[model samples]
Target chain A: MSEFDEGTAVVRRPDEAVDSSVFDTELDKGWQIGGGINGGLLLSLAARSIGEHFAAARGLHPYPVSVSGYYVSASRPGPAELRVETVRAARSHSTGQASLLQADDEGRTLERLRVLAHFGDLARADEDVRTSATPPKLPPVEQCVGTEHAPPEFLASANMLERIDLRLDPAYVGWALGKPSGEGRIQGWFRLADGREPDPLSLLFALDALPPVTFDLGLFGWTPTVELTAHIRALPAPGWLRITHSTRNLAGGYLEEDCEIWDSRDRLVAQSRQLAVVPR
Target chain B: MSEFDEGTAVVRRPDEAVDSSVFDTELDKGWQIGGGINGGLLLSLAARSIGEHFAAARGLHPYPVSVSGYYVSASRPGPAELRVETVRAARSHSTGQASLLQADDEGRTLERLRVLAHFGDLARADEDVRTSATPPKLPPVEQCVGTEHAPPEFLASANMLERIDLRLDPAYVGWALGKPSGEGRIQGWFRLADGREPDPLSLLFALDALPPVTFDLGLFGWTPTVELTAHIRALPAPGWLRITHSTRNLAGGYLEEDCEIWDSRDRLVAQSRQLAVVPR
Candidate 1:
């Protein structure tokens, strides 16, 4: 019996001392409330930092800023590193490239990312643009929730999506979900199950998880995001991350997915685009 | 002249051809380089098909799979009208969506995409992969290709980038014929003087272009794509489409690009990605 935050996990055991092998040492620390860091966590961390960099560079603070796009390339884990290089710095908008490196013990590059961001230009809101219908809203996290399933694969997922406050908003809200395979288009909401603030890379890794929810049988637990790109519209306050993903229209077994992230304010925070092939 | 194969445009005088405003009116009737009716031309037609419906349905495709990303909600022009609907035709691998609309005065969906694709059950290329410094071995279409004042507010972009064939093999070969203005990252062996195929979009179009190269800029004109997710190993053929693009490292301005498409033989088709700023 422990207390939990709205979006964070509540660790109930730490001293239980579970037997661990290769994955036990660093992970078992906060068994009762661990959500510290993992692959997705790093991505989210990276995203946050990159977003902040843009917000400041573009003077887009106070007002929300969205993530324009993200490309997460897969690699074996190693030393965590982030290299941010600017693309353009303008009076109104600013763009840059960020790469995160997770190197092996030998200092070799493993996985990394190159993120693109546009900041300070809220001017588009004034332009004659049509915002996509708000994805059907979801039951507040307070309504209902699910417990965590710590499968070996989940652990292997690098904690990117370790703790998610997920729900399929409403009926007909999505094409893919906890039902028959959909036409690939999906819609839903997500948040840190533990409510812990994850980094940008961490968020990206977690996002890599969402698009494959329908494709992965949840059996072997191997969902590889060959390539992932995200576009951000806003950086919502940490809590829940809303999203919609689809792949059903997959051609050549090859498919692509576009996802958007939203905050409670209804402001679009980020968009994710991905290309993956489900192995038959 | 050398024999033009499929996908090659059949040149015709402006008056000798149908009105250009009417799409599919044959801007240039070229050899049939498509499967029945699928090819780059058809895909472009299908892409500009239904801006609203597809945006509404939010469907994704994985076959003949489009490499378009970066979408800016724009007003439909007076070309024709279209309505894209994602339909699950009775097919496998090729299971995909279609739209119905008019490419002419009759508001009809003259174009639709049928996919014949299934996820490759084949194992991913071995984890131990490698990339070729061998580079794409293709001569640039000319000393300078691409267009200079193509039209519209494409901005700073000179000739269609038909200037040079960028090389990444053996060593990175880069040659930009003009000095463009924009505080960001730019790369690739762009050509000029508009002497190559008239592409529809580049990977980084702010105009609704998708990926493998999900980019940020408004995809306004024709831009080729080259490069891909990366390599644990070199490709089957680093043909002419093989090109390399990076932020080239940004400082005060930006640093980003998107995907660079390459020919099966590794010739540089187009390179995309993006860049941003860091401020001093």
Candidate 2:
């Protein structure tokens, strides 16, 4: 498999002039295809980009904060424009959204997301914490991914899921991956690696692709994301992204979803959820 | 406190020339307020109403399969108007979005949610059955709702919340009532009074109003929501809405978020998460 170029890791703004040469018909399917970023990957990157914009607007460091959720509606691909809008910026937290539109080879605004972001706001008085359960533990990551038990390798290959290693937590054992890096309910470590250093925003781009395994409960085995969301608990580490998520299957073929993130130290990082369509 | 007249759990829809009295008086605020129900609450009811409509359209039980995250932009409150359009509907799942609008009796569009919904398809898969972990033991209901550990009576007095009770899982053994739901992680039980028939939509309405108890890891506190989302996993059986969530602190005060939901049988019910404004 071709490796992600080491140089592509630098934060590239959507508004920046991108070479149409990077656009490949073959990439219409590549994770970083159109304009060199696949829809899913682009969705994640767009979210991180929005977060970064929010931070830069406020002159906050550690760069962009995090993502709440991301959606990618489609038209034909190419010349798509992603516009970031800062919704609200608070002391402990901030909020922003991005609209990624697919214009026909030229620029026509086909589909978009008002992508959203959030961060820790320290403005209020610390209230009593309601989260108290230790993150459920899980088996080794080796048991799930890279194993015979996993679905077709093509599934993993298609996801191009970067920097995440999941293991079912032995406790609730509910899709627990590993630990995050904060001081709240969530506890996991995360970082993006395309052979470059990952900023807080880049790490999140990688985090938003995985679905809560618990949603698998209703799986006769079809998974399609009608919508996707992420709640970053804390800024992640620099090499790998680890987390645990559980999904609740509703009566019909639909799923209302939720996923929580923890920093590596078992500190509360970010929590998130979404509603999705079960591909029939 | 007066009880919600459980007479007919139906909304006075516009088609029937229903009473528009409650929605009068447009209030300019981040939230749209109706005399009887808030925007969040109305959205839930509307989903149910539309869900049934889809079911009737397809000759099904009008099963609500899922909901895209709830998006609430700023709006003026007055006699509100909602318009719903089906995105795609199939025998398995029906999906659609609705727009909620309000004008000062002048037919101006206040806010729109292209709210998407999915219904009728539910999956039951093994391989991921992690329900072995029982809901942790916690104190009885009375103690939790009446203590200083919770927001004092008035702030907590919203009538819609009266029928629900939440408690900290003793396994985590938290003090100060407990930590609020974190960014992508949340935990707790919620349900209507025992014996009340369970309505997937009603549970959903509650889910929408759910407040993420995210605390500031940097300052340790709670933040307001710019947006909230809910996902349904399984059909609930008139039980408590067990929930868990966490947060990610970001630059310029922004973040990404996620959350999960469950029923009394400890069955995975649904999940939700959102990007919210965590104020400093």
Name the candidate that leads on TM-score: 2
Candidate 1 regions exceeding 4 Å error are A1-42, A48-78, A105-111, A121-129, A137-162, A168-179, A185-187, A194-206, A209-211, A216-221, A235-241, B1-280
lDDT of each: 0.33, 0.43
List residue ranges in candidate 2 displaced over 4 A.
Answer: A1-28, A32-40, A45-193, A208-222, A235-240, A243-280, B1-43, B49-61, B68-78, B87-91, B99-116, B121-133, B136-196, B208-223, B238-266, B274-280
Mind giving the per-residue lDDT tens digits that candidate 1 earns over A17-55? 222101111112222112233333334444444544544
lDDT of 2 by residue, B171-272 (tens): 322323444322333345555433454456655655544433343233334443445555555667554556554443333244444455556676656555
Candidate 2: residue A95 Cα off by (Å): 6.6
Per-candidate interface DockQ score: 0.03, 0.13
TM-score of each: 0.42, 0.58
- CAPRI docking class of candidate 2: incorrect
The alpha-carbon lDDT assigned to residue B129 of candidate 1 equals 16
